[model samples]
Target chain A: MMQQERTKVILGVIGADCHAVGNKILEHVITAAGYEVVNLGVLVPQEDFVNAAIETDAKAILVASLYGHGEIDCRGLRGRCEEAGIGDILLYVGGNLVVGKTDFHEVKEKFLEMGYNRVYEPGVLLERVIEDLQQDLQERGLSRD
Target chain B: MELKNKKWTHDQFYAIRGEVLNQWPTGAAVDFAEAVKYHENIPAKKHFAKQLVKAKKNGRTLTQPRAGVALINEHINLLNFLRTEGEADLLPTTIDSYTRQNQYAEAENGIEESKRAGRSLLNGFPAVNHGVAGVRKVIESVNGPLQVRHGTPDARLLGEITLAGGYTAYEGGGISYNIPYAKSVSLEKTIYDWQYCDRLVGIYAEHGIEINREPFGPLTGTLVPPSVSHAVAIIEGILAAEQGVKNITLGYGQCGNLFQDIAAIKALEQLAEEYLNNHGYPDCVLTTVFHQWMGGFPQDEAKAFGVISWGAAAAALAKATKVIVKTPHEALGIPTKEANAQGLKTTRQLINMLADQPFPLSIEVQSEIDIIKAETRCILDKVYELGNGDFAQGTVAAFAAGVLDVPFAPSRYTLNKILPARDNHGAVRLFDIGNLPFTQDIIDFHQAKMNERAKAEGRNASFQMVIDDIYAISKGRLVGRPH
Candidate 1:
């Protein structure tokens, strides 16, 4: 019997944000759920995420922004991913995603319009994220064999 | 440059001071001789070290808040408001992020931008950009003693400007500021830079001026275990003492468990004194600071008050010299002055209520203290052995070998192998101990506590629990249980 290789996923806190707690948590939760987490750590650029996804053939890129500047930092990230030729790669973002208290529905709709596959409000459980990843991966036929 | 835990000679210090003071145009204003004279004229009541000594003698827990703004007059007014309306016992001049990064040019622009906008644009006071005279203006305007609260990895020029400007206390150590605050700064570099800062304080002490030096005790502040933080605090204390610093205040973040929080403070004070004395620095006056929960707070203002009050109760009961207050607007970005004062008043009320109430030294707290001591001793011993009795070398090696890992630290120097989670009662336990130099018995103790939580939650002891615990407090719970 041969062991199977884990499915690949990219994770990081996008832009000049240095919040590492949630990014580390995401890595742990995703890796424990049987995925090869390419943790980009904190203060990552938009290009790094797309480049990593393309290099590793990761099924998804989980971008986190906790410094409340995600609106500006994350702008046009999807178009950059498309230019890098991994536009279809799943993009999941969460955490204090806006400058102040905005309706979650509005925030979520805005991110979706920006081409993110999913947008999470602050305090969403990691379990829910992992489940979403599994379902999304399966629907895209990118699930582990 | 070979880094060692030895004190720099006056010649060596002056040589570096020449360059350090030339970092920006503001640095040119730092005249050590004149500054010492100015410091001599500061009233004893407005002296940071003097006030802390008085607080310790009276068995009082002082309250301080984290605050600053871009402009000078606004910053002065803010500190005064916190002193009067908030009833903060101590005041802080928190430095802006650009200054923390040594980006004085950007800080200058921030000051200009703030002036044109008719409102402060920066998160904190740009002390370095303000220069000695500017800092002196704010220092002279504020009623109480002020401390420079910042996360600068290289605080050499900032230290010169602020100290010369009349701030009596400085916060952050090489290790404390670097590992948690920077992404790629080396331990050797930060530790070396911080030695210069400490030496300046020592020079002040030599001139009969005692300046308080605090090692930021809350590394990463997210689920950090007691032993890890304790080990870092003791190391930093010894490092400061080596540089001739005589007055040191070590700090610790609230871990949320009452017994554990109190035990941590007791263990930190005792361990710091022992290490400093054993290292041949017995004259150092040590104080302890309890930082109100450094993690996420509930978005609701009422719930935020509960968190702040709990932290105050812990600090008061622990009899720490002072408590760093947190605002109810914590969950929402930078707090308004009113919210900041409300947090301080809330903490003051709790401290006033709990001042006379004695927290019992129960068996649970004793056990926690004992465990923390043993675990901390193990790490310190390894650090010593790794350095061949040199703390500077030992610290760099400890992080490299994963012997002194801080959980969730962003430094490339640290191995970052440790993972912390809460147990059944919300006490932090290691899910993965990483390469921490803990004895088998200590490892077993943490594992058992983790196992108990797993059983209670009807879940396996895995990373899921760690995730849940991270957001538990913000969701208004201690232990994150399955719903």
Candidate 2:
């Protein structure tokens, strides 16, 4: 029998952030999408993520946060990922990340500077994220569907 | 050395919170050490402290001193010194030395300690907690190795195990208006927050980590119970990418009839689970509070009955990943540390004692505990899903709709009487019915029992405030409504 296609997705909320709602949602969505998801739930520190990505040879790391202090909370995170040698993985983040409002472009620019593949707002159509992921998978010739 | 490492002389702690805490029936009076080992919530703390002061003033000879909050907060520096320096200092002046420091951590072996020993990070709550931080750090003790640095706590701990010191929403009194997450001051404020979400994600991405959801806010203490829409707004706001994110803590805790909270979370969890599973993600956490307001000690029989009944209900149908059982005395003033200790001790015991016992999740627990939980959830869910956040007016609507029988607001209906008068803003003024402060009687007895237990355990167990009366509820058949 032909093996079922699987994409190892290491998922968790990063930094000092502990929002479990979206983390759970992504788990539900991607598992159904036929990818193998390592559901690392909330309040996760940094090293665990890097270690998991390295251990599983994961294709992606999805981050979620709803607390306002994500800006200060998420400092020095990406460099750790690079140091851990998982720089080629697809990275996705969603949910409210900052405290006290500001501009989205600036937020996007900051994330880009730090090293992120894509970022999403709280209510990004899950379909869009899926579609983008699919395109990335297809380009890599790893698309299951 | 352990004895010598001790910081304070018992007399000082007794004087601070003792007079205020002795008004309850928590069993008997005990000492500071016993209070630390036992008790939970704010009221219990206050009552126990009061009891300790009374015992000392009366010249009661004690066996050993105790460790209480007032003592800990007042003399935090000394404890930290002993805890870090691994040495003891002189008497009297030593206590003064402990009190002199303003922080919880200094330096030891080049490592920094948390300052939570003195106070908490749970900021903004019931007018009383206005200045206090509801969040505190508790070092988690797990059975396995930490996934992070060697000798460090693991990050990939198993299902729903506690964090080294997770930040919990202290919902005693902070208003909904205070949170920066919602009630944005302007569109710019909202956009900036959204951007910040993106940056946080990248931080993790750089580290090959993924955040599912950051549970923020004061939980179920306010109106609107932080709906799915709010969750959606948050997601839409900042998170520009969600390759790995999953759940959010929008599913806050216990308040009024959980009909709405339960149903919404179930729908949201199921919905998100389905959506995320289809998208390739794990089922994330959806918080549901089974607890009600009023932790610590019960001020009166009615308040005690109410909180106890609520706790019993929480034990059965709490669908959340973890549940926090409120102490009986939360409605009163700030619980003495002794009281909080009691509650935590009980919680730990219950964790083990109730482990294998099957909580009738189905209908009929002799006392409609299961029914109330289920019925409340089902009706509330149907309404919320149908209402689509339109008819979402706290627990009032849900109760009127028959989804909930209990009112979330502090009103006369809870006691079967007329409601209170309103202020200019239409908010209820006097919160009376079940609002009684912690009593001295209960505090004293409970402390004594604790002291006795401590003594039996071969520890120095002395102090006037340790009341033994509090444990009555521990093994006492959950009378009046619980199973």
Candidate 3:
């Protein structure tokens, strides 16, 4: 059997949010699920995510905001990624994105509007994020395994 | 920039007000005089200050839940549900993040998008985006007092819009909102911004409108020692009072130790009154709000209810003027409205059951109270000394010198030098005092407390203990001991 190349992805909690537990858990889960994760720790800025994406040639940038300020930090990230010439890069964000009790569908729609390819709700199963990533990458013809 | 205890002059306030009102379109709609008129017409029952005063006099602990969504109608419906279903005594319109960051444009887009989708796109009520008219619609729909609960360091616009919209209470202070919530907000800047908020309240208070002001208590909501949070609340309360705020509700986050929780509340109310009186604000009405456990919750709903009920019992026993309830779905992301209601129901049941019970005054409880008071005095005296008797100035310098510290806080402005761990009895004690100015005896007290826990666990008092304690409650243990 031909050896398959590992799918690389960048993961982090973004922008002044130091929620390490979830980031650690996500990295472990994704790693165990057979993906190479470039864990950027916490408090990651937008440029750092983009730079890491280009540096690692990662297929996706998974952003987590556990402190309810995701919309501000994740806003215009897609545009910024495009400016960095990574427009087609898969963008995912979730976790208490806004401060108040917003509907998940509305949160999802807002992220989609902001150019995120997928937005996970807080407490969303890790397997779902992985399954969706696999399907999305396969659809984009980026899968090696 | 000198952090003195001086109220802003009308001209100075107007100069800042001009720029503030221009921050967003809603700013222009906030006619202070018109807002005053609207407030005057609002019934006494809907006034937060009046309700709080009544609760304090009656010795009843009011319950308030955190709930907000994007659309105005939905947010109103949610608050109404909390009022009827959750049995909340006070309601909160938690501001959305975009508005908290002053990103009114994005918040505006969120509101419109929410309307188009027939669902709330924003996480909060987007009070600024809603402006006065929209917020007034919410105020009109709600049956009781509504507060604007948000963690905005620069809440000048929010304060203006919400107060104008008939919100009777506003939660947050410069340090409380800044140190825990933001990463890079300077102490100097947040104090100044919060002065604007207090001054806005002052402006209303001057017009014979009593608005309740609360400082974000439970700083970082980790294993914060009582004295640490107490010192901050007293400072923020004095700051609010200096700005002419007559009604102050200082808050403390539940530390998961019952005796310590009761002691902290009693100490907070006593110290606030003492400090305000010494500062010549004899008229300042002091109240206490006990926030339910603000740290990690168990993933299980039943376990989460245990945490909520524990907090409720503590709040009731402490005779706190109000309790900020948490939902059973806390470990999860923002709770559904139903979950929020469930949390309030749990809290209501616990408080009501314990309502007839008086807080027991035991020898141990008395000692904890005395120790907490002494430690708080040490911290506050150092802060006052640092500011040369100016609380605001001292606060800035205190954080700069690490004389005051909050552990696990994200703000670079906070010293983050203090490390806290539960004692043998699960009371939060300082594991690392850092630059906190404490007497040698107080320092020894904390050390001895930790030593007792360490000896029991057969381990040295170390950072590992702090880490364990952080997750202990989630694991159904208070003291995180190694196997």
- Looking at model 3, the pairs that clash are A100-B123
Per-residue alpha-carbon lDDT of candidate 2 for residues B1-483, written as tens digits (9 for 90 to 100): 111101122252234223312311111132323222222222321222222233334422111111112222332432233222321110011111011111111111001111333332111011111111111111121111111100001101100111111211111101111121121122222223223332333333334332223332222133222231233322221122232223233334333333433443344444444433443334433333233332123444345545544443443343433333343334332233343333434443443354445343332222223222332234435444444542223222332333322112221112211111111221111111122111343234334444444444454332111111111122231111112
- TM-score of B chain for each model? 0.99, 0.36, 0.98
Q: Report the lDDT tens digits of candidate 3 across residue range B1-483.
A: 565767887787888898888888888898888889999998988888889999999999999998888888899899999999999999999887667777788778878877886766566788987889999999999998999998887999888888988899999998988887776679889999999899889989999999999999987788889999999999999889888999999999999889999988998888889988998789998889999998878878899999999999999999999999999878766787899999999999999999999977787788989999999999999999999989989999999899988887767787777888999999999989999899999999989988898899899997667867877887777778898
For model 3, what TM-score does chain A reach? 0.95
For all candidates, what are the clash counts?
Answer: 0, 176, 1
The TM-score of candidate 2 is 0.32
Candidate 2, B-chain TM: 0.36
The local distance difference test score of model 2 is: 0.34
Candidate 3 accuracy as lDDT: 0.87
Error of 1 at A23 (Å): 1.4
Candidate 2 CAPRI classification by DockQ: incorrect
Top lDDT: which candidate number?
A: 1
- Pairs of residues clashing in candidate 1: none
Model 3 stretches astray by more than 4 angstroms? A1-12, A15-45, A52-62, A67-145
TM-score of every candidate relative to the true structure: 0.89, 0.32, 0.87
Q: What DockQ results for candidate 1?
A: 0.26
